[model samples]
Target chain A: DAGVTQSPTHLIKTRGQQVTLRCSPKSGHDTVSWYQQALGQGPQFIFQYYEEEERQRGNFPDRFSGHQFPNYSSELNVNALLLGDSALYLCASSQTGTGLYNEQFFGPGTRLTVL
Target chain B: DQQVKQNSPSLSVQEGRISILNCDYTNSMFDYFLWYKKYPAEGPTFLISISSIKDKNEDGRFTVFLNKSAKHLSLHIVPSQPGDSAVYFCAASGAWGTDSWGKLQFGAGTQVVVTP
Candidate 1:
């Protein structure tokens, strides 16, 4: 079965611009979460979506938002992008919302470059 | 503040030797910990995990040890191979209840190189 898939392997956006990155969860998975990984650093959780609603969010500002469709696919939107927004955006899927024992399957990730 | 810290930015080990990666967290409420391995241009893959109730969990050649009192966890890889060289990250989360649903706090990551 196919694992998680993300669209537009890479993206380039200018300051004050907005961009949307897409993700298709792994087969048989329902929950989707987004993370940002800067060069040489570990990923930082952005937010998580379940049942089409954001269940939990990290310390990110309001400029970051996301949505989960009925099919369990997800989209991460970042508005007013700044140079610091340039990073690898990763999408992970889990079988359940419990988040404790559930192991997350990650996509290759979309590299976002804010110019 | 960085709740999770991996002080060693990188490490090198000879092939067939033992490789131990360490991680420390300041959050006492973190009840679940995980270790992930990542290659360049790829998202991290889950390696192993241990719950707070348990001190150690092992799977094949990979093992995870948790010290709740010291707020530290470690990943041990035996007989390290060149293929095992990659960046390792330590992640932790609060209880798995409804409110905290899998929110993970990650460390800076430690790069491991297995020299043949």
Candidate 2:
């Protein structure tokens, strides 16, 4: 079976511009989460979507938002992007029934480069 | 403050030897711990994990040991191969507060290189 998949392997944007990244969770999975990994740091949690509603969010600014469709696919939208927004956007999928013990499958990730 | 920390930035080991990567966390609420291996330009791949109730979990060549009293966890790889070279990240998930159970806190990661 195919694992989690993300669209637009890479993206380039200018300051004050907007960007949208897409992710399709692994088959049989229902929860989707997003993370941002900088140049030399580990990924920082952005937010998580479950039941088509945002369940939890990290400390990121309001400029970062996300949506989860009924099919369990997700989209991450960053508005008024800044230079610091440049990073690898990773999408991870898990099953809600497993709760905290579920192993999340991650996609190849979309590399966002803000110019 | 970093709730999860991987003090070692890199580690090198010979082929057929054992490689041990360490991780420490300060959050007692973090009951579930996981290790993820990431190659350059790719997302992390789940390796192994241990729950708070269990002190150890093993899967194939990977073994994870958890010390709840010390709030430390480690991933041990036996007979390391060159393909094992990558960045290993320690992640934890739990209901620390009102937060969702799916949220995870990750460490900076440790790079491991296995030489032939």
Candidate 3:
């Protein structure tokens, strides 16, 4: 089976521009979560979506938002992007009821470069 | 604040030997810990994990040891292979059934290089 997939392997945008990145969860998974991995650092949680509603979020600004469609695909949108917004955006998927012990499968990640 | 910390930025190990990667955390609330391996340009792949209630868990050539009292954990790879050379990340989460919902707190990753 195909694992998690993300769109736009790479992106480039200037400050104040809006960018949207997409992700498709692994087959048989119902939850989608987003994370940001800065260079030389581990990924930090951005937010998670279940049942098309945002269930939990991390310490991110309001400019960062996301949406989960009926098919469990997700889109992360960053508005008024800043130079620091550049990072590797990763999308992970897991079953809704698997809880914390279950493994989270990740996508290849989209490289966002803000100029 | 970084609740989880991986002090070593990089480690080199000879192939066919044991490779140990350590992680420490300050958050006592964290009850579940995990390790992930990532290659350049790719997202992290789940390696192994251990719960707070358990002291150790092993899978094939990989094993994880957790010390609850010290809030520390370690990943041991036996017969380390060249393909095992990658960035290893340590992550933790609060107890299940809480609002955490798999939102993991990760440490600065440690890069492992295995040479033949």
**Per-prediction count of colliding residue pairs?**
0, 0, 0
Query: What local distance difference test score does each model get?
Result: 0.91, 0.92, 0.93
| Fraction of native contacts, model 2 | 0.68
Model 2 global lDDT (CA atoms, 0 to 1):
0.92
Worst 10 contiguous positions by lDDT, candidate 1 chain A? A95-104
lDDT of 2 by residue, A1-115 (tens): 9999999999999999999999999999999999999987888889999999999898899999999999999999999999999999999999987554757889999999999
- Return the candidate ranking by lDDT, descending: 3, 2, 1
Query: For all the predictions, what are the DockQ values?
Result: 0.76, 0.66, 0.75
Please list the residue runs of candidate 2 whose C-alpha ends up more than 4 Å from where it truly belongs after superposition: B95-100
TM-score of chain A in every predicted structure: 0.96, 0.97, 0.97
lDDT of 2 by residue, B1-116 (tens): 68899999999999999999999999888878899999997889999888889999999999999999999999999979999999999998875343536778899999999999
Candidate with maximal TM-score: 3
What is the RMSD, in Å, between candidate 2 and the native fold over all Cα?
1.3
Worst 10 residues of 2 chain A by lDDT: A96-105
> Which candidate would rank higher by TM-score, 1 or 3?
3
lDDT of 3 at A107: 99
Candidate 3 stretches greater than 4 Å from native: A99-102
Which of the two, 2 or 3, has more DockQ? 3
* lDDT of candidate 1 at residue B16, scale 0 to 100: 97
lDDT of 1 at A82: 99
